[model samples]
Each structure stands twice: as structure tokens, then as C-alpha cells.
Target: MTKTFVIDGKTIPFEDGQTIMQAASAAGVYITHLCHNPQFTPHGSCKLCTVNVNGRNCSACTFPASEGQNVTNISKELNEDREKITQMLFVEGNHFCPSCEKTGNCQLQAVAYHLNMTDNHFPHFFENREVDASHPDVMIDHNRCIFCTLCVRASEQVDGKNVFAISGRGIDKRLVVNSPSGLLKDSALDVSDCAAHICPTGAILIKRTGYSVPIGQRIYDHAHIDAVALASEGEAHDH
Candidate 1:
């Protein structure tokens, strides 16, 4: 017998150590999130995955799912809150989707679409951030960084490089390279580094691979992020 929890009336089974977001994703139940990746430790920074657990709001990515616990994931008020969080991400950075290389493949844009966000509700920050293209094979467009720290974790944990880190605090916070000069060229990051590929936004990108996939044939263009995982699993099984 498996232990289970109720999320939006859906009974989701989970192992002892699984969080609500983990159990939900494993069950093919999509709970909205941004700063979450199965390969990395749950940061729960994005608050987009916030859900009502036992009548109180908690981050589903980090909240443990107990047997018989009632979790409210999708609802009118929750979706509205999610929409605001998504909007804040947009305004906090210069996320100009039209001209961005990660447009269709971007998780931020995809999640915005998932939340039915038609406009940026908050005022744009338009903060002038530097774009570091000094690295031969990679580029860092700080303008699009959502501060998810996926790259920071990937570099430190997987690549064992500790090549990326976040600096400052709150509105003044920004990504920094691990180098004496604080430049990508001074760091040891390679194109094959997991950190190079983990960014969910256009903040980090391969140098010469822009627009490699046609806009119409991009990942999100063909399927929503919620279905992409399951669809990819199906394709892998076919192979």
C-alpha cells in the first residue's frame, strides 16, 4: 500500500522523502514552478509553486507530502497569485521575448503562457545589466536572468567547478562568475558544463547556437511544459 495526498481532488501517491511537487510531477500532475529541477536540490525561491497545504500556503517544491494531507494547487485565487509572481519575474528583468534567443524554449515564457498571462502587470525595471560575451563559447545576458540560481547549483554540485554564484542582496543581487576579474573569460566554464545548459531563461546561452531550432518547431511551441516531460518519457520509451 502507498501513502497518498489529495491535490486539487487528485489522489497522488508518494514515497516517504518526496515533496509535494516531486510526487505531483511523478504522477503527471503539473504544479506550477520556476526554480525547481528534479536534478537539483529544491530551492523553493520562486514561490510560483506555492500551494495551500492543510489550509496554509507553502512551497510545494519543499513541502513534504503526508498521507491524507489536503493540498490545493489549482484554484481561482492561487492561479491569480501565480500570475502575479510570473508578472514580477517579467518586470524584474528585461525579458523581451520577441528578440530573445530562448523565446519559445524559455521556461519563464512557457509558464507565463501556462498561467494565461497576457500582459506584464508590474512596472518594468529596465535596469541596465551587463551582457558578458567574453567567453569563447558561452554568453551571459544578465538582462534576462530571473535569479533562479540553477546555473549556480549545477556548477557547484554537478560540474564541481563552483564557477557561478549570486552576489548582492534583494534588488541589488546579480549573478557573478567565479574569477578574480569577475568575467566569464576568467572562469573555467566550458560549453559542455551542466551549468551552461541548466538556465531556464536566456541569461545563459551557447555562443553560436542562437535560433538553431525554428520558432514554430520549438519545444513549447509544440507542447506545453506540463506535457513535455511525459511526452519526452514516451519518446524515450519508444527508443
Candidate 2:
């Protein structure tokens, strides 16, 4: 018999080595998260997947799923907290969705819409960050990054290129290029690199491809994020 755990009243089975996220995704359950790319190792930095597991708050992305454990995934308080977290992410960055090319295709935006984030609850940081258009086919707009490290892990794991890394401490945290000149043009990144397109936001983008599909006909334009996230990742795990 398969070992199982209860998440939001639904029983989800899991193998020994699978994390709570892996099991949930395989079972068609969506746990809101930004830092989790099943293609790469789980990085629980976002804390968006925080669930009430047996009266304790733990990151579902890193927390292992065990037998008979009760997990509270979707609740009133959980959804409210997720909305606040999404709002904080917006205020921390310079996200102008109307002007952004990744407006409709962005995961962050989709998550915000999914959680019903109607307005910016907090004050904007408005931090002046870098927009490196030095690379001919790629660009880095630091203002939109939420520090999810998707690009950083994608480069190292998939492309086998250590082209990106997150540097600095808390509050001062920022993405850093691997080149000596500290620019995308100087780095060993190409248009085909996994890191070039793995950003969950508009932080990293391919040049000249902006608005290719138009705003209204984009990824998140029609579908909700719960459906989108289900179809996006997590296929090669212990399914």
C-alpha cells in the first residue's frame, strides 16, 4: 500500500523520497509557490508554500511528505496570507505590468491574480536597480526580480553554466552575473540558455521577442494560475 497524507481533506500518496510539493503536484494539487521548479532542486526561499502541517508552519517545497500526516493547504487564513505575501513582492519590486512585455506570461502576475490581490497594500520600495541591455539577445531588468532563484538554478542544473548567482545579504539581496564585468554581455549566457528564460518574472528576458504574442493572447490571459501551475512543471518526479 502507498503511504499517504491528508492535505486540505484530500488524501495524497507519496514515495519515501518525495517532498510534499512533489507529491501534491503529481496528485494534481496546487500549492502556491514561486521558488519551486521541479526541474531543479527545491529551494524553499519564497516561503509561499507554507502550509499548516500538524499545527506547525513548514515549507511544502522542502518538507517531506510522510504517512498519515495532516496538512492544511488551502484555508481562509492561508489564502489571505498568500495574498499579503504576493502584495509584498509587488511593492518590493518595480513592477509596472502595463508596460512590461511579460505582463500576461509572468507567473508572479498570475499568482497575484489567483490570490485576488486587488491593490498594493504596502508602500513601494521604488529602488533604483539595473537594466542591463548589454547583451545582444538577452537582458536583465533587476527591478522585477523577486529573488526566487529560478534562473540561477536553471543555469547551473540544466545549462551546466554557472551564469547567475544571488549575492548580497537580506534586504540588500540582488542577482549577480558570473562575468568579471558584472554584465550579461560578458557572461557565458546565450539565447538558448535555460537561465535566459527561467525567470518567473520579467527580470530576465530574450531581446526582440517582447510582445511577440501580444498582451491579450498570452499564457495567463485566459487561464487561472492554479491551472497554469499544474501544467507548467513537475513531470519527471515519482509520478
List per-candidate RMSD values in Å: 2.3, 1.1
Off by over 4 Å in 1: 230-239
Query: In candidate 2, what are the lDDT values of residues 31-74, reduced to their tens digit?
Result: 99989988889999988899999999999999999998899999
True-structure lDDT of candidate 2: 0.91
lDDT over C-alpha atoms for residue 114 of model 1: 88
Tell me, by lDDT, which candidate is best.
Answer: 2
Task: List, residue by residue over 1-239, the lDDT tens digit for candidate 1.
Answer: 99999999999989999899888887778888889887778899999999999999999989998999999999999999999999999999999998999989999999999889999988888999999999999999999998898999999889999999889999999999999899998999999999999999999999889888989889898688789855543343234
Candidate 2: lDDT of 163?
94
TM-score of each predicted structure versus truth = 0.95, 0.97
Query: Which 10 consecutive positions of candidate 1 have the poorest summed lDDT?
Result: 230-239
